[model samples]
Target: MPDRITLTGLRVFGRHGVFEHEKRDGQEFVVDIVAWLDLAPAAASDDLTQTLHYGELAQLAADIVGGEPYDLIESVAGRIADEVLKDSRLSAVEVTVHKPSAPIPLNFADVAVTVHRGRA
Candidate 1:
Protein backbone atom coordinates (compact mmCIF):
# COMPACT_ATOMS: atom_id res chain seq x y z
CA MET A 1 0.00 0.00 0.00
CA PRO A 2 1.20 3.50 -0.74
CA ASP A 3 1.74 5.81 2.19
CA ARG A 4 -0.58 8.79 2.14
CA ILE A 5 -0.18 12.34 3.48
CA THR A 6 -2.75 15.10 3.68
CA LEU A 7 -2.65 18.78 4.59
CA THR A 8 -5.86 20.70 4.97
CA GLY A 9 -7.45 23.95 6.10
CA LEU A 10 -4.65 26.21 4.92
CA ARG A 11 -5.92 29.76 4.93
CA VAL A 12 -4.64 32.65 2.82
CA PHE A 13 -5.68 35.98 1.39
CA GLY A 14 -5.49 36.60 -2.35
CA ARG A 15 -7.08 38.29 -5.32
CA HIS A 16 -9.04 35.85 -7.50
CA GLY A 17 -12.24 36.74 -9.19
CA VAL A 18 -14.05 37.64 -12.39
CA PHE A 19 -15.43 40.96 -11.28
CA GLU A 20 -13.44 44.16 -11.05
CA HIS A 21 -14.52 44.73 -7.48
CA GLU A 22 -13.31 41.32 -6.35
CA LYS A 23 -9.98 41.74 -8.10
CA ARG A 24 -9.61 45.16 -6.48
CA ASP A 25 -10.61 43.79 -3.06
CA GLY A 26 -8.97 40.48 -2.31
CA GLN A 27 -10.69 37.63 -0.49
CA GLU A 28 -9.86 34.79 1.85
CA PHE A 29 -8.96 31.49 0.20
CA VAL A 30 -8.70 28.17 1.95
CA VAL A 31 -6.62 25.41 0.43
CA ASP A 32 -6.57 21.66 1.00
CA ILE A 33 -3.85 19.42 -0.36
CA VAL A 34 -3.44 15.65 -0.36
CA ALA A 35 -0.29 13.84 -1.41
CA TRP A 36 0.20 10.09 -1.72
CA LEU A 37 3.55 8.33 -1.60
CA ASP A 38 5.51 5.57 0.08
CA LEU A 39 6.28 6.91 3.55
CA ALA A 40 7.69 3.73 5.02
CA PRO A 41 11.29 4.93 4.76
CA ALA A 42 10.65 8.22 6.48
CA ALA A 43 8.59 6.53 9.18
CA ALA A 44 11.31 3.98 9.85
CA SER A 45 14.30 6.29 9.57
CA ASP A 46 12.71 9.35 11.20
CA ASP A 47 14.27 11.50 8.50
CA LEU A 48 12.47 14.40 6.91
CA THR A 49 14.11 13.78 3.56
CA GLN A 50 12.29 10.47 3.30
CA THR A 51 8.87 12.11 3.48
CA LEU A 52 6.96 15.12 2.28
CA HIS A 53 7.31 18.27 4.37
CA TYR A 54 3.81 19.67 4.72
CA GLY A 55 5.20 22.94 6.01
CA GLU A 56 6.92 23.47 2.70
CA LEU A 57 3.79 22.47 0.87
CA ALA A 58 1.80 25.02 2.85
CA GLN A 59 4.35 27.66 2.05
CA LEU A 60 4.08 26.79 -1.60
CA ALA A 61 0.35 27.18 -1.38
CA ALA A 62 0.77 30.57 0.21
CA ASP A 63 3.05 31.60 -2.59
CA ILE A 64 0.56 30.47 -5.15
CA VAL A 65 -2.28 32.22 -3.41
CA GLY A 66 -0.31 35.40 -2.99
CA GLY A 67 0.77 35.37 -6.61
CA GLU A 68 -0.82 37.59 -9.24
CA PRO A 69 -4.61 37.51 -9.69
CA TYR A 70 -6.31 34.63 -11.43
CA ASP A 71 -9.55 34.74 -13.38
CA LEU A 72 -10.86 31.44 -12.06
CA ILE A 73 -10.29 29.01 -9.25
CA GLU A 74 -9.93 26.27 -11.84
CA SER A 75 -6.74 27.91 -13.09
CA VAL A 76 -5.41 28.10 -9.57
CA ALA A 77 -6.30 24.48 -8.89
CA GLY A 78 -4.60 23.40 -12.12
CA ARG A 79 -1.44 25.25 -11.17
CA ILE A 80 -1.41 23.59 -7.77
CA ALA A 81 -1.77 20.16 -9.33
CA ASP A 82 1.09 20.86 -11.68
CA GLU A 83 3.27 22.11 -8.83
CA VAL A 84 2.59 19.07 -6.65
CA LEU A 85 3.43 16.76 -9.51
CA LYS A 86 6.93 18.22 -9.50
CA ASP A 87 7.81 15.90 -6.60
CA SER A 88 9.04 12.67 -8.11
CA ARG A 89 7.99 10.54 -5.18
CA LEU A 90 4.39 11.67 -5.37
CA SER A 91 2.01 9.21 -6.99
CA ALA A 92 -1.00 11.43 -6.92
CA VAL A 93 -2.26 14.72 -5.52
CA GLU A 94 -5.55 16.43 -4.85
CA VAL A 95 -6.12 20.15 -4.41
CA THR A 96 -9.23 21.86 -3.16
CA VAL A 97 -9.56 25.63 -3.04
CA HIS A 98 -12.23 27.30 -0.99
CA LYS A 99 -13.47 30.87 -1.26
CA PRO A 100 -15.51 31.60 1.82
CA SER A 101 -16.24 35.25 1.22
CA ALA A 102 -17.14 35.14 -2.46
CA PRO A 103 -18.97 38.15 -3.77
CA ILE A 104 -22.16 36.36 -4.49
CA PRO A 105 -25.49 38.11 -4.50
CA LEU A 106 -27.39 35.32 -2.78
CA ASN A 107 -26.55 33.88 0.62
CA PHE A 108 -24.10 31.06 0.48
CA ALA A 109 -21.52 29.54 2.75
CA ASP A 110 -18.64 29.27 0.28
CA VAL A 111 -17.40 28.20 -3.13
CA ALA A 112 -14.71 25.67 -3.94
CA VAL A 113 -12.90 23.85 -6.70
CA THR A 114 -11.21 20.45 -6.41
CA VAL A 115 -8.71 18.91 -8.80
CA HIS A 116 -6.77 15.65 -8.85
CA ARG A 117 -3.65 14.58 -10.72
CA GLY A 118 -1.58 11.43 -10.98
CA ARG A 119 1.96 10.95 -12.20
CA ALA A 120 2.19 10.38 -15.91
Candidate 2:
Protein backbone atom coordinates (compact mmCIF):
# COMPACT_ATOMS: atom_id res chain seq x y z
CA MET A 1 0.00 0.00 0.00
CA PRO A 2 1.14 3.55 -0.70
CA ASP A 3 1.32 6.35 1.81
CA ARG A 4 -1.96 8.13 2.16
CA ILE A 5 -3.06 11.71 2.67
CA THR A 6 -6.59 12.15 3.91
CA LEU A 7 -8.95 15.08 4.29
CA THR A 8 -12.26 14.44 5.94
CA GLY A 9 -15.43 16.18 7.05
CA LEU A 10 -15.15 19.12 4.73
CA ARG A 11 -18.53 20.77 5.04
CA VAL A 12 -19.88 22.86 2.22
CA PHE A 13 -23.37 24.07 1.37
CA GLY A 14 -24.57 23.11 -2.08
CA ARG A 15 -27.81 23.17 -3.98
CA HIS A 16 -27.59 19.61 -5.22
CA GLY A 17 -30.57 17.32 -5.47
CA VAL A 18 -33.34 16.06 -7.69
CA PHE A 19 -36.03 18.10 -6.00
CA GLU A 20 -36.67 21.74 -6.71
CA HIS A 21 -36.92 22.65 -3.04
CA GLU A 22 -33.59 21.04 -2.40
CA LYS A 23 -32.03 23.14 -5.10
CA ARG A 24 -33.58 26.24 -3.68
CA ASP A 25 -32.90 25.65 0.02
CA GLY A 26 -29.60 23.84 -0.31
CA GLN A 27 -27.96 21.69 2.38
CA GLU A 28 -24.71 20.84 3.99
CA PHE A 29 -22.54 18.26 2.25
CA VAL A 30 -19.60 16.50 3.80
CA VAL A 31 -16.66 15.31 1.74
CA ASP A 32 -13.80 12.95 2.43
CA ILE A 33 -10.80 12.40 0.18
CA VAL A 34 -7.92 9.98 0.36
CA ALA A 35 -4.99 10.37 -1.98
CA TRP A 36 -2.41 7.62 -2.38
CA LEU A 37 1.13 8.44 -3.39
CA ASP A 38 4.74 7.81 -2.59
CA LEU A 39 5.80 9.78 0.51
CA ALA A 40 9.46 8.82 0.73
CA PRO A 41 10.78 11.78 -1.18
CA ALA A 42 9.00 14.29 0.96
CA ALA A 43 9.81 12.39 4.11
CA ALA A 44 13.49 12.13 3.27
CA SER A 45 13.97 15.72 2.20
CA ASP A 46 11.38 17.29 4.51
CA ASP A 47 10.24 19.36 1.58
CA LEU A 48 6.66 20.32 0.78
CA THR A 49 7.33 20.11 -2.96
CA GLN A 50 7.64 16.33 -3.00
CA THR A 51 4.13 15.68 -1.76
CA LEU A 52 0.58 16.75 -2.48
CA HIS A 53 -0.49 19.89 -0.65
CA TYR A 54 -3.61 18.92 1.27
CA GLY A 55 -4.73 22.51 1.92
CA GLU A 56 -5.01 23.00 -1.80
CA LEU A 57 -6.76 19.68 -2.08
CA ALA A 58 -9.32 20.66 0.55
CA GLN A 59 -9.94 23.98 -1.18
CA LEU A 60 -10.38 22.18 -4.46
CA ALA A 61 -12.95 19.82 -2.99
CA ALA A 62 -14.74 22.69 -1.28
CA ASP A 63 -14.91 24.59 -4.55
CA ILE A 64 -16.38 21.60 -6.34
CA VAL A 65 -18.93 20.93 -3.65
CA GLY A 66 -19.92 24.58 -3.48
CA GLY A 67 -19.79 25.40 -7.20
CA GLU A 68 -22.14 23.30 -9.36
CA PRO A 69 -25.32 21.45 -8.68
CA TYR A 70 -25.60 17.72 -9.28
CA ASP A 71 -28.61 15.49 -8.92
CA LEU A 72 -26.59 12.68 -7.44
CA ILE A 73 -23.73 12.35 -4.99
CA GLU A 74 -22.11 9.89 -7.38
CA SER A 75 -21.47 12.65 -9.89
CA VAL A 76 -20.00 14.80 -7.15
CA ALA A 77 -17.70 12.04 -6.03
CA GLY A 78 -16.60 11.36 -9.60
CA ARG A 79 -15.81 15.00 -10.19
CA ILE A 80 -13.70 15.24 -7.04
CA ALA A 81 -11.84 12.06 -7.95
CA ASP A 82 -11.16 13.34 -11.44
CA GLU A 83 -9.84 16.65 -10.19
CA VAL A 84 -7.67 15.09 -7.49
CA LEU A 85 -6.14 12.70 -9.99
CA LYS A 86 -4.82 15.59 -12.03
CA ASP A 87 -1.71 15.49 -9.88
CA SER A 88 0.61 12.89 -11.41
CA ARG A 89 2.15 12.22 -8.04
CA LEU A 90 -0.98 10.50 -6.88
CA SER A 91 -1.57 6.96 -8.10
CA ALA A 92 -5.14 6.63 -6.82
CA VAL A 93 -7.83 8.43 -4.89
CA GLU A 94 -11.02 7.71 -2.98
CA VAL A 95 -13.78 10.29 -2.61
CA THR A 96 -16.78 10.05 -0.32
CA VAL A 97 -19.64 12.54 -0.44
CA HIS A 98 -22.10 12.54 2.42
CA LYS A 99 -25.55 13.99 2.06
CA PRO A 100 -26.98 14.23 5.53
CA SER A 101 -30.07 16.16 4.54
CA ALA A 102 -31.32 14.01 1.71
CA PRO A 103 -35.05 13.94 1.24
CA ILE A 104 -35.90 10.47 2.45
CA PRO A 105 -39.16 9.37 3.97
CA LEU A 106 -37.53 7.19 6.61
CA ASN A 107 -35.19 7.98 9.45
CA PHE A 108 -31.56 7.62 8.48
CA ALA A 109 -28.21 8.90 9.57
CA ASP A 110 -26.71 9.88 6.25
CA VAL A 111 -26.70 9.30 2.50
CA ALA A 112 -23.33 9.09 0.82
CA VAL A 113 -21.44 7.90 -2.26
CA THR A 114 -17.87 6.75 -2.57
CA VAL A 115 -15.76 6.48 -5.72
CA HIS A 116 -12.32 5.00 -6.22
CA ARG A 117 -10.22 5.94 -9.22
CA GLY A 118 -6.72 5.23 -10.42
CA ARG A 119 -4.39 6.39 -13.13
CA ALA A 120 -5.20 4.82 -16.48
Candidate 3:
Protein backbone atom coordinates (compact mmCIF):
# COMPACT_ATOMS: atom_id res chain seq x y z
CA MET A 1 0.00 0.00 0.00
CA PRO A 2 1.33 3.39 -0.98
CA ASP A 3 -1.01 5.55 1.05
CA ARG A 4 -1.20 5.75 4.83
CA ILE A 5 -3.37 6.98 7.68
CA THR A 6 -1.49 8.55 10.55
CA LEU A 7 -2.60 9.20 14.11
CA THR A 8 -0.22 11.00 16.45
CA GLY A 9 -0.01 12.11 20.06
CA LEU A 10 -2.78 9.92 21.40
CA ARG A 11 -2.32 10.08 25.17
CA VAL A 12 -3.71 7.84 27.88
CA PHE A 13 -3.03 6.85 31.49
CA GLY A 14 -1.70 3.36 32.22
CA ARG A 15 -0.01 1.30 34.89
CA HIS A 16 2.75 -0.31 32.84
CA GLY A 17 6.16 -0.67 34.34
CA VAL A 18 8.52 -2.99 36.15
CA PHE A 19 8.71 -0.88 39.29
CA GLU A 20 6.20 -1.57 42.07
CA HIS A 21 5.32 2.08 42.54
CA GLU A 22 4.82 2.48 38.79
CA LYS A 23 2.32 -0.35 38.80
CA ARG A 24 0.59 1.10 41.85
CA ASP A 25 0.49 4.64 40.48
CA GLY A 26 -0.19 4.87 36.79
CA GLN A 27 1.42 7.39 34.46
CA GLU A 28 0.69 8.99 31.11
CA PHE A 29 1.43 7.21 27.86
CA VAL A 30 1.58 8.62 24.37
CA VAL A 31 1.01 6.62 21.20
CA ASP A 32 1.54 7.32 17.54
CA ILE A 33 0.25 5.06 14.77
CA VAL A 34 0.57 4.85 11.04
CA ALA A 35 -1.49 2.40 9.01
CA TRP A 36 -0.68 1.43 5.45
CA LEU A 37 -3.52 0.75 2.98
CA ASP A 38 -4.59 1.28 -0.58
CA LEU A 39 -6.32 4.65 -0.57
CA ALA A 40 -7.24 4.66 -4.24
CA PRO A 41 -10.31 2.52 -3.78
CA ALA A 42 -11.78 4.80 -1.18
CA ALA A 43 -10.77 7.94 -3.03
CA ALA A 44 -12.26 6.75 -6.31
CA SER A 45 -15.44 5.45 -4.76
CA ASP A 46 -15.76 8.27 -2.25
CA ASP A 47 -16.95 5.76 0.32
CA LEU A 48 -16.05 5.55 3.98
CA THR A 49 -16.28 1.78 4.01
CA GLN A 50 -13.48 1.44 1.52
CA THR A 51 -10.90 2.95 3.87
CA LEU A 52 -9.71 2.65 7.44
CA HIS A 53 -11.49 4.92 9.87
CA TYR A 54 -8.86 6.63 12.04
CA GLY A 55 -11.35 7.63 14.74
CA GLU A 56 -11.99 4.02 15.58
CA LEU A 57 -8.27 3.34 15.57
CA ALA A 58 -7.64 6.17 18.03
CA GLN A 59 -10.29 4.85 20.40
CA LEU A 60 -8.92 1.34 20.16
CA ALA A 61 -5.38 2.54 20.91
CA ALA A 62 -6.61 4.44 23.94
CA ASP A 63 -8.45 1.39 25.20
CA ILE A 64 -5.42 -0.85 24.84
CA VAL A 65 -3.10 1.60 26.59
CA GLY A 66 -5.48 2.18 29.50
CA GLY A 67 -6.53 -1.45 29.89
CA GLU A 68 -3.51 -3.63 30.57
CA PRO A 69 -0.36 -3.47 32.68
CA TYR A 70 2.76 -4.46 30.75
CA ASP A 71 6.31 -4.22 32.00
CA LEU A 72 7.73 -3.17 28.66
CA ILE A 73 6.76 -0.62 26.06
CA GLU A 74 7.61 -3.27 23.48
CA SER A 75 4.62 -5.24 24.66
CA VAL A 76 2.44 -2.18 24.38
CA ALA A 77 3.57 -1.49 20.84
CA GLY A 78 3.09 -5.11 19.84
CA ARG A 79 -0.45 -5.17 21.18
CA ILE A 80 -1.32 -2.01 19.34
CA ALA A 81 0.13 -3.37 16.12
CA ASP A 82 -1.94 -6.50 16.49
CA GLU A 83 -5.10 -4.47 16.92
CA VAL A 84 -4.31 -2.23 13.97
CA LEU A 85 -3.71 -5.23 11.73
CA LYS A 86 -7.09 -6.73 12.59
CA ASP A 87 -8.54 -4.78 9.68
CA SER A 88 -7.66 -6.60 6.49
CA ARG A 89 -7.69 -3.36 4.58
CA LEU A 90 -4.55 -2.27 6.40
CA SER A 91 -1.53 -4.01 4.91
CA ALA A 92 0.83 -2.75 7.62
CA VAL A 93 1.05 -0.74 10.80
CA GLU A 94 3.77 1.20 12.59
CA VAL A 95 3.22 1.83 16.29
CA THR A 96 5.25 4.01 18.66
CA VAL A 97 4.64 3.89 22.41
CA HIS A 98 6.11 6.67 24.52
CA LYS A 99 6.58 6.67 28.27
CA PRO A 100 7.44 10.14 29.46
CA SER A 101 7.10 9.44 33.15
CA ALA A 102 9.22 6.31 33.14
CA PRO A 103 11.18 5.34 36.23
CA ILE A 104 14.46 6.79 35.15
CA PRO A 105 16.91 8.68 37.32
CA LEU A 106 18.40 10.67 34.46
CA ASN A 107 16.79 13.76 33.00
CA PHE A 108 15.77 12.69 29.50
CA ALA A 109 13.21 13.96 27.09
CA ASP A 110 11.23 10.72 26.72
CA VAL A 111 11.41 6.94 26.39
CA ALA A 112 9.72 5.11 23.56
CA VAL A 113 9.52 1.89 21.60
CA THR A 114 8.48 1.68 17.98
CA VAL A 115 7.44 -1.49 16.15
CA HIS A 116 6.18 -2.43 12.69
CA ARG A 117 3.86 -5.33 11.88
CA GLY A 118 2.16 -6.33 8.66
CA ARG A 119 1.11 -8.95 6.13
CA ALA A 120 2.79 -7.38 3.16
Candidate 4:
Protein backbone atom coordinates (compact mmCIF):
# COMPACT_ATOMS: atom_id res chain seq x y z
CA MET A 1 0.00 0.00 0.00
CA PRO A 2 1.01 3.68 -0.32
CA ASP A 3 1.08 4.17 3.45
CA ARG A 4 3.54 1.63 4.76
CA ILE A 5 6.56 1.92 7.02
CA THR A 6 9.23 -0.76 7.19
CA LEU A 7 11.94 -1.35 9.74
CA THR A 8 14.54 -3.89 8.69
CA GLY A 9 17.65 -5.63 9.94
CA LEU A 10 16.79 -5.46 13.62
CA ARG A 11 18.90 -8.02 15.45
CA VAL A 12 18.57 -9.57 18.87
CA PHE A 13 19.75 -12.53 20.93
CA GLY A 14 17.32 -15.16 22.18
CA ARG A 15 16.84 -18.83 22.92
CA HIS A 16 14.57 -20.58 20.46
CA GLY A 17 14.93 -24.05 19.06
CA VAL A 18 13.48 -27.54 18.83
CA PHE A 19 16.45 -29.03 20.58
CA GLU A 20 17.28 -28.58 24.22
CA HIS A 21 20.94 -27.82 23.55
CA GLU A 22 20.17 -25.10 21.09
CA LYS A 23 17.51 -23.76 23.37
CA ARG A 24 19.87 -23.50 26.30
CA ASP A 25 22.78 -22.27 24.19
CA GLY A 26 20.72 -19.43 22.66
CA GLN A 27 21.26 -17.75 19.28
CA GLU A 28 21.18 -14.48 17.44
CA PHE A 29 18.02 -13.38 15.69
CA VAL A 30 17.45 -10.71 13.07
CA VAL A 31 14.07 -9.11 12.60
CA ASP A 32 12.62 -7.29 9.63
CA ILE A 33 9.27 -5.61 10.25
CA VAL A 34 6.87 -3.92 7.89
CA ALA A 35 4.01 -1.84 9.23
CA TRP A 36 1.28 -0.38 7.05
CA LEU A 37 -0.73 2.58 8.30
CA ASP A 38 -2.18 5.87 7.18
CA LEU A 39 0.51 8.44 7.80
CA ALA A 40 -1.21 11.60 6.59
CA PRO A 41 -0.54 13.53 9.78
CA ALA A 42 3.02 12.35 10.26
CA ALA A 43 3.71 13.03 6.61
CA ALA A 44 2.23 16.51 6.65
CA SER A 45 3.43 17.78 10.02
CA ASP A 46 6.56 15.59 10.35
CA ASP A 47 5.72 14.95 13.98
CA LEU A 48 6.78 11.74 15.72
CA THR A 49 3.53 11.66 17.66
CA GLN A 50 1.32 10.80 14.70
CA THR A 51 3.32 7.80 13.49
CA LEU A 52 4.37 4.50 14.96
CA HIS A 53 7.52 4.83 17.02
CA TYR A 54 9.93 2.40 15.35
CA GLY A 55 12.22 2.31 18.37
CA GLU A 56 9.35 1.26 20.59
CA LEU A 57 8.26 -1.34 18.11
CA ALA A 58 11.73 -2.78 18.00
CA GLN A 59 11.89 -2.95 21.76
CA LEU A 60 8.54 -4.66 21.92
CA ALA A 61 9.54 -7.16 19.28
CA ALA A 62 12.81 -7.90 20.98
CA ASP A 63 11.16 -8.16 24.33
CA ILE A 64 8.57 -10.56 23.03
CA VAL A 65 10.88 -12.84 21.13
CA GLY A 66 13.81 -12.61 23.50
CA GLY A 67 11.85 -12.77 26.70
CA GLU A 68 10.28 -16.14 25.98
CA PRO A 69 11.63 -19.45 24.79
CA TYR A 70 9.57 -21.04 22.08
CA ASP A 71 10.15 -24.32 20.30
CA LEU A 72 9.53 -22.79 16.92
CA ILE A 73 10.60 -19.57 15.29
CA GLU A 74 7.28 -19.57 13.50
CA SER A 75 5.55 -19.01 16.82
CA VAL A 76 7.86 -16.14 17.61
CA ALA A 77 7.33 -14.57 14.23
CA GLY A 78 3.58 -14.99 14.36
CA ARG A 79 3.35 -13.42 17.80
CA ILE A 80 5.30 -10.42 16.57
CA ALA A 81 3.01 -9.99 13.60
CA ASP A 82 -0.05 -10.09 15.83
CA GLU A 83 1.46 -7.73 18.39
CA VAL A 84 2.37 -5.17 15.74
CA LEU A 85 -1.08 -5.35 14.26
CA LYS A 86 -2.65 -4.78 17.69
CA ASP A 87 -2.17 -1.07 17.15
CA SER A 88 -5.45 0.33 15.96
CA ARG A 89 -3.68 2.71 13.61
CA LEU A 90 -1.78 -0.05 11.87
CA SER A 91 -3.65 -1.88 9.15
CA ALA A 92 -1.08 -4.56 8.44
CA VAL A 93 2.17 -5.95 9.74
CA GLU A 94 4.80 -8.43 8.56
CA VAL A 95 7.33 -9.95 10.88
CA THR A 96 10.45 -12.01 10.22
CA VAL A 97 12.80 -13.75 12.62
CA HIS A 98 16.19 -14.99 11.47
CA LYS A 99 18.25 -17.52 13.34
CA PRO A 100 21.86 -17.22 12.19
CA SER A 101 23.31 -20.19 14.00
CA ALA A 102 20.98 -23.11 13.68
CA PRO A 103 21.91 -26.65 14.60
CA ILE A 104 22.07 -27.91 11.06
CA PRO A 105 25.43 -29.39 10.16
CA LEU A 106 25.51 -27.84 6.74
CA ASN A 107 26.62 -24.23 6.75
CA PHE A 108 23.98 -21.65 6.07
CA ALA A 109 23.78 -17.94 6.53
CA ASP A 110 20.59 -18.15 8.60
CA VAL A 111 17.19 -19.73 9.10
CA ALA A 112 14.15 -17.49 9.30
CA VAL A 113 10.42 -17.45 9.94
CA THR A 114 8.08 -14.87 8.44
CA VAL A 115 4.44 -14.03 9.16
CA HIS A 116 1.84 -11.48 8.12
CA ARG A 117 -1.30 -10.40 9.93
CA GLY A 118 -3.97 -7.75 9.51
CA ARG A 119 -6.27 -5.77 11.71
CA ALA A 120 -9.57 -7.41 12.58
Specify the highest-lDDT model's number.
2
lDDT scores of the candidates, listed in order = 0.90, 0.95, 0.93, 0.89
Q: Per-residue lDDT for 1-120 in model 4, tens only?
A: 749888889888899889998678898889999999999989899999999999999999999878889999999999898888888899899898988888889979878888989866
Name the candidate, 2 or 3, with the larger TM-score value: 2
Best by TM-score: 2
* Error in Å for residue 25 of model 3: 0.7
Estimate the TM-score of every prediction. Answer: 0.96, 0.97, 0.95, 0.94
Residue 24, model 3: lDDT of 94
After superposing candidate 4, which stretches have Cα over 4 Å from the reference?
none
Output the lDDT of residue 42, model 1: 96
10 residues in a row with least lDDT, candidate 2: 64-73
Residue 118, model 1, lDDT: 95
**Over the stretch 12-79, how does candidate 1's per-residue lDDT look in tens digits?**
99999898877898988999999999999998999999999999999888899879889898888889
- Scanning candidate 1 in windows of ten residues, the lowest lDDT window is 1-10
Error of 2 at 34 (Å): 0.5
Residue-level lDDT for 78 in candidate 1 = 84
Give candidate 3 misplaced runs (Cα > 4 Å).
Answer: none
Model 3, residue 39: C-alpha shift (Å): 0.7
